[model samples]
Target: MKKRLVVAITGASGAVYGVRMLQVLSQLDDWESHLVISSSGALTALHELTMRRPEIEALADVVHNVRDIGASIASGSFQCDGMVIAPCSMRTLAAVAHGLADNLITRAADVMLKERRRLVLLARETPLNLAHLRNMTAVTELGAIVAPPMPAFYNLPGTIDDIVNHTVGRTLDLFNVEHAGLLQRWQGLKKTAALVKESVSREHLISI
Candidate 1:
């Protein structure tokens, strides 16, 4: 049977991360995605990314409203492989850390933690205060992986899409997902130079 992956998007600034994750998951055959979005997430997505709410909703196999606390995902028996909160807002993070299942996203995350399943949170914020640190520490202590969407300069990304894909690729890596051609891995500059030189030399030889 295919593995179920729960994806939650809360009220965070990086809405593109959530959208890219859904797009990436859509390409995988062995993974089924159940999506949930907070109401504020919808607003942020529209205002920031100019994405229609329906466009985001259509990306998932099943979309649950954040208000739906009694959804199937709330229970630990849902048999999910993992849960990922892309662009996890501080509000949602606090709820998850405190085990306050006021919404479906928090409830699902709580279930993941209780069941000892993988819970990856892509926390998006800067200049985090003590409260943010405490919540992150609390969740990490409970076996949740807190991954901030920090950009990697090593990838030498040239475009906005490159940065987004790299972040999403790293996020998928936390789930042990096999993704190729998404982001370039770090290779020694000498080796890369040699490879490029070899290619140029071959072309020169062909021209001769």
Candidate 2:
């Protein structure tokens, strides 16, 4: 059977993660995407991506209204494989951590947690305050993975899209979904001697 994954886009800096997620998922035959975009999410997409509303909506298999708390994805019985909130805002993080289901994005995430399903949040803030850390810790304690999309310079990404796709691919790894061939896995370092030297250096530093 095809797996269903709910994807939410929130008001955060990395709108591209959400957009790239939809674009990648759209090409996969084994998975279906349910999308929810917050009011602020839409505004951010326009400002950050300069993408039209229709263009954004066109990428998802099913688009949900942020105000529709009664949507199918809002229920625990919806039987989706998992949910991902790409570029998750700290506000949304606090709400989900506190069990606030005022909006569909938060509501669906709440359901994912209650049902013991995988819920990945690409938290998009730096210089985190205590509240943000507390919220993240709270959600993590409840089985939600707070996966901030920190860039991997190790991948040697050539462009912004490469960086985004690499992060998206690893995020999708949680659901066991095969990415659209964009994920670059880390093989053993070309110079094993370098790894040995680095490990020895760290050990010596600790000893010192």
Candidate 3:
């Protein structure tokens, strides 16, 4: 059975993360993605990625307006496997932390919490002050996975796509999604050793 997934894009600087997440979700056969974009998110997507709002909307299986508090996702009865907020803003995080469901995104998040569904928050902010950490702790206590968008250098990422894929792959991991060709696992390093051995052999022959 396909899992119902809710993806919310709040007012954050990293709109590319949200775009890549939607693109990845579209390729999944066993998942249905419901998307909600905050008003500032739309602007950020346009300014950062130069993608039009309609084009962004087309990426998701279902698009819900952020202002629509009456949306089905806001209710606990709407059965969803999990909810992910890619590039979650501080404002949204704080709102959800305090149980203030003023908008559809926070409201749906609250529903996920109350319903004991998986909630993954990709909090995108820097220089975490005490307040941010406190809010994160509060949500974590409620069974929400508060993942910050921190890049990993072990992947030897070369391009922007590499970074995006690594982040998305990590996000998918929270939902137990298997992602290949994104990041190499530690066990996969065995292949790199073989390549290095071959390179060393070739170098020795050339030197001889």
Question: What is the per-residue lDDT of model 3 for residues 1-208, given as tens digits with 9 covering 90 to 100?
Answer: 6888899987888888888888888888888889999998888889999998899999899889998999989999998888999889999999999999999999999999999999999998898899999999999998899988888877778988888888888888888876577665445668788999999999999999
RMSD of 2: 5.0
Model 2 TM-score on a 0 to 1 scale: 0.91
Ranked candidates (lDDT, high to low): 2, 1, 3
Model 3 stretches astray by more than 4 angstroms = 188-208
For model 1, which pairs clash?
Answer: none
C-alpha lDDT values of all predictions: 0.91, 0.92, 0.89
Q: Can you give the TM-score per candidate against the true fold? A: 0.90, 0.91, 0.88
Q: Residue 96 of model 1: what lDDT?
A: 94
Residue-level lDDT tens digits of model 1 in 12-129: 9999999999988888998889999988899999998899889998998888888888889999888888999988999999999999988899999999999999999999889999
lDDT of 2 at 165: 88
lDDT of 2 by residue, 125-177 (tens): 99999999999999999999999999898878899888888899999898998
Against the correct fold, how does model 3 do in TM-score?
A: 0.88
Q: Is candidate 1 or candidate 2 better by lDDT?
A: 2
Best by TM-score: 2
**Count of backbone clashes, every candidate in sequence:** 0, 0, 0
